[model samples]
Target: MTTSRGGDGQSSVEVGTFIKTPSAHIVEILAVAGLDFAVLDAEHAPFDFGTLDAMLIAGKAAGLPLFVRVPDFQPSTLLRSLDLGAAGVLVPHVDTPEDARNVVARCRYKAGVRGYSGGSRSSGYGEKGMLAAVADAESVQIMCQIESIEAVDNTRAIAATQGVDGIFVGRADLALSMGLADSQHPDVLKATERAIAAGVSQGKRIGVVASSLEERKRYSDLGATWFLHGSDQSLLKQAARALVRA
Candidate 1:
């Protein structure tokens, strides 16, 4: 999808949702629904590698950029997801510049440790040579999730790390870390603002998981360029509740 520029010359905000259900059809549906992107929640959802492979294929077939939220900082997991053809990977719990640097290293090939594989889907199934494959791999986005107070404090350094494409604020986990029940707690908001500002200072794209359109707008005004709204299951539940009410 083409990114439009806002009046202020910044890229227009992109809105996507999480995919919790392990279904390729669901991926197709999200693509047809015209969302900006879809992030498969591998960290919290029950998604087997085979299912993930199918979902990624569906996303590619339907023209949707699919990102995988990996369970952790495992290099093998990151490499496998990239090989499966995800547009990007959202690494969770990156609380320091050191962590960010390690993630970048694992996701790259030239100056990093990602294993070479020309047969992977990302490499056009061996059609692309080694040089082309490495270049394509380097183009994949790497978004580090800033979910803890420590991460918020280290936001600038994390964003400044070479090869980190963006920062995705994880408010729910941040709230839990802060010993709060509400993701919208004032302290959480303050920390999130600080993190966003830090990312912006480094000229990095900022992202957040907002619970509603209003919350999304609030963060957007604070310079978050992308948002992940409710997940597939959450949307289904909401629609079912509405149907019952109707």
Candidate 2:
């Protein structure tokens, strides 16, 4: 796990939070809520790289692991995200060996030539311990999204790609790719399970975004150690309901 800036920068285990939708205050909210890590969703959400940096700053202020889920398999985007100081990066649609390598390289520094700016949130905004920070960026957390049949089929090879830290199953998108309207179908469940199992055997941490605590438990039982429990919108709806009940 990457050590955050402050606020009990003292924890050991890694807890990752996903930010799929947008809100300027999301980073501050989740950070104060005690999340070990938080991700900005650039894939499906409307967040630009600049906004991502801002969110990272907010999360870091609270000592939360700051990460960004880049839009696609583009190395430039991934490189930009890493340079901005994402504690880690979640690359979506990792369906091939090349895609996996692309992301892995983005995390790398000198050996890979990712552009650098010393004074940024990523390198403690200065030269202080920048080399160590670069090393951490290379080996830190790299989560690949399993969201299609291609990824499901290429699971073993994808995991074998050196430097990948974990897997996050995108059930909804995978279902859509498989021509299913939703993730409730048994077929999608089987595919998701297969991916999770493959990840476990390969010694990679497995994860998914569960819609509820029950769903979280179910996936946890299936050996997913990393869980991005739900979306910003879902949390809001649940909180609103609770407030109404209260």
Across residues 1-246, which tens digit of lDDT does each residue of candidate 2 receive? 632333643212345566866655877788778776777878778888778777776766677777788887576887778777677788889998778877787677756656666776667667657777676566657889999999998887788788888888999999999999889799999999999888877877787877667887787777776777666777888899999999
Candidate 2 lDDT at 138 equals 65
Using lDDT as the measure, which candidate wins?
A: 1
TM per prediction: 0.97, 0.87
Worst lDDT window (10 residues) for model 1?
A: 1-10
Off by over 4 Å in 1: 1-4
Q: What is the lDDT of residue 126 in candidate 1?
A: 93
* Deviation in Å, model 2, residue 217 alpha carbon: 2.0
Regions of candidate 2 where Cα sits further than 4 Å from its true position? 2-16, 20-24, 244-246
Question: In TM-score terms, which candidate is top?
Answer: 1
Q: Local distance difference test, per candidate? A: 0.92, 0.77
Clashing pairs in 2: none
